[model samples]
Target chain A: MVRFENVGMRYGLGPEVLRDISFHLQPGSFHFLTGPTGAGKSSLLKLLALSHRPSRGLITLFNKEVSSLARDDLPAMRRKIGVVFQDFRLLDHLSALENVALPLKIAGAKNSQIYQHVAELLEWVGLGRQVDAKPPTLSGGEKQRVAIARAVINRPQLLIADEPTGSMDAEMGLRLMYLFQELNKIGTTVVVATHDLGLIKRFGNPVMFLKDGMLTTRKQDELPSQFSRDGG
Target chain B: MMQIIGKSAELQLEKDVSTRYLPVVIAAMIFLAALAIGGLFSLSNAISDWSATLTGNLTVEIAFDPTADLDKKVTDAVELLSKTPGVAAARAIEQEETLKLLEPFLGRNAALGDLPIPRLIEVIIDEDSAIDLAALNEKLGEAVAGARLDIHRPWLDKMVLLGRSVQILAAAIMLLIGAVTVIIVIFAVRTGLIMHAEVIQVLHLIGARDQYIAEQFQNYFARLSFLGALPGLIVAIIVMFIFNFLVGSLEASMLPPLSLGVEGIIALLLLPLMVALLTRFTVRRVVLGSLERMM
Candidate 1:
């Protein structure tokens, strides 16, 4: 669950990049965040993932205000959530299996449990044969899948992917979306940001549209397409 | 069977490529440090041996007198020393032996028989004796005219002070070398951190503890320090043995043998271990400090 009220953010001495943003997400909910380039969508997701401190406003996560949490306490809170970066920030020195096993190791899972769960998950993600391959040797789509596997390996309660399939073909993007959708079906809250309108129609998750740092919902009456839906 | 296990210590992000230079830096620092410490210990032991000899001895010199018989005067001084309460033994140095003692300043074949060299009476005293030098000098003067008592205590004091000063200087140099080692390690760790920053950032984002990340770097540097210091220590000891083999006899006549006793050997053997721990500590601090800046 996340709540942001009047949240504004900026780098030092710069004009505000995200201004007066307020949104709410209930537990076990799914939403698609849509915006054109330079729409501040990534900045907003950063605030949600607790990676950046907002210049002003209240952001609450899991019913507790994030600004009030101590730095030492942030890791435990972060471990509860998963994030997929646009760059698929996999460690190049690590093989695909090691990269996927990172979250479990950080969580102090036993070695045997990590091996078993990570192997099974990599096999499920179509990276079964590339488990020993490093990121530099893996294809773009394979790296993306490794990133997704690492993100969800711990079954994080809140899963966020920023441009998860941005570099993939249409079918590959759809297949990755199905992976996220499968995670959602298993009751993991999912939020994905992308510019793909066709994929939006295919998935049919309610869209949260952002332009010039402001968020608005697309209602059924306002939509030109037949799939407009209610949003929470 | 072909899975990559994610042990942070096995992460080669920082250890790769830097191995070529890090060991060389550590080895050079260690070599200088070991040489300084070895010389310091050797000087300290030699000074103690010299001090003990000086503490337990004195000398009586009878000036060469043409009017009086010089041998009789030297004999009288030796007789008096033998009868003295705290005197242990007294013997007159033969003219030939005195000529050999002066060979450094005078030519080996110089005619010393024609020159007016003092007749020397060597005196050994009981270590625990409380003999008063002024009273003993008065008694020796009354026994033989112009017989001078040289107690060696004040000269020993000055020599001891000079030896201490040298030890202090050697210790200061050793400490400077140690500081240089720390700085080198700091620079090395910083470079490694910069090269591996991406891996570290990903690790941090994945919720790894600062200590968990630091262990990877710390273990790497500790092992490097241990291995690097080994060659330096080995080379330094080898140099020591070779130098002694070449000039050992000449040096032994001037001072005690330059040997590392039990304590010195233990300290030498432990140098590499201490270097390892120091490197580990320095690297851990740098890693944590840099991570704290990130936060």
Candidate 2:
């Protein structure tokens, strides 16, 4: 669960990139965050991820005030939330299996347990045959799957993905969305930041839309009838 | 805590695909540092030994004793020297003993045969002795025939100056080594940071703590330095041994052979520990410095 109220963020002396943003997500809920480029979507996710402090207002995760948390305590807080980066960000020298096993290892899981779970997840993501391959050698879609697997490997309570389906084909993108749906069904709260309107329409989740630095929330049923006509 | 650091370090190290030779570079740096430190240690020890040998003793020679009562005058001089405040013991060298000492200078078979050598009296001083050379010389003038006092002042001055010079040189070499260590560690840490910049950025974006990120680099550098120090220590010991043997054979009064007693060995053992500490400190500082910039 995450809550942001009147949150504003800026880089140094620059003008605010995210302003007057407000949202709350309950446990096990899924939401789609839709925005155009430079709409402050990434900045908002960064605040929710607890990576950057809000210059104004309150941001809370799992009912704890994150702005008051010490820097050293951030890692343990991060362990409860998993993130799939737009760039994938898999370590190039690490094998796919290692990259996927990273969060569990960071959380001090036993080697045998990590290997077993990572293997099962890689198989589910259709990367079982490329488990030993490094990121540099993997196709864009394969790398995206690997990143997704890594993010969800810990079965985190909150999952945040930025452009999770950007590099994948329609089939792969839909499968990835199904994977996220299954995670939400199992009680993991999911929030995805994407500009892919077709995916959002097909998924039919409550959508949080941002323009410039402001946010507005709309239920799927309340979407304008012409929402389906929006271009990707 | 250690497990977290180890895992994080492994991830960081694995992330840099181009730094396959990092271990080798660290080892080489450590090796060179150890060699420099070991050489300084040996040189300082030798200087200490040389200074100790020259500090307390004096020599007296009766170069010309034409009178038949030379033995009586020698007895009188012995009495005078024994009464002197600084002279603990005085003994006259016999003819045969003097010949044995000169035998090396003049070859054994070709040393001017049966030559008359000077009558020398070797003097040993007590540790607490404070002899006034001018006073002792004036006293010896009336007590013995043709008595020539060689207090070894000039040679002692030269030896002390040489010892001090070596110590200074050794210190300068150590300072140079420390500077090089700092430079190398900074360069290596920076290179690693640059190589893993994406991973670092991702970690930062994901809310990984600064300490967590720094631990990754600190662990890598500590291991690299540890690995480097071993070979440096090995090479230093070997070179020390070879130098010791070479100096021993030369028998140069100016250069004492390298002698590592129990204390010396203990000091050498501590060298690796110093290197490890240096690396840990340097790596930690560099990593923390880089993190400060990130903030």
Best by lDDT: 1
Clashing pairs in 1: none
lDDT of 2 by residue, B13-129 (tens): 745555455556655665565555555566667666655665566678777545456566667778888988878888887767877788888977865545656678888878866
Question: Which digits, one per residue and each the tens of the lDDT, describe model 2 over residues A151-191?
Answer: 88878899999999999899989999999999999999999
Best by DockQ: 1
lDDT of each: 0.83, 0.77
TM-score of 2: 0.78
Candidate 2 stretches greater than 4 Å from native: A123-141, A219-232, B1-39, B60-70, B80-89, B93-120, B125-158, B203-216, B223-273, B292-295
- Model 1 ranges off by over 4 Å: A220-232, B1-11, B14-19, B63-87, B92-117, B127-147, B249-258
Candidate 1 per-residue lDDT, tens place, A1-232, comes to 8899999999788988898988898888889887667778998988878778899999999888988987787777788788898999888878999889998988899999998899999999999988999999988888999999999998888999999889798888989999998999898889999877777777778878877778888742343342233321
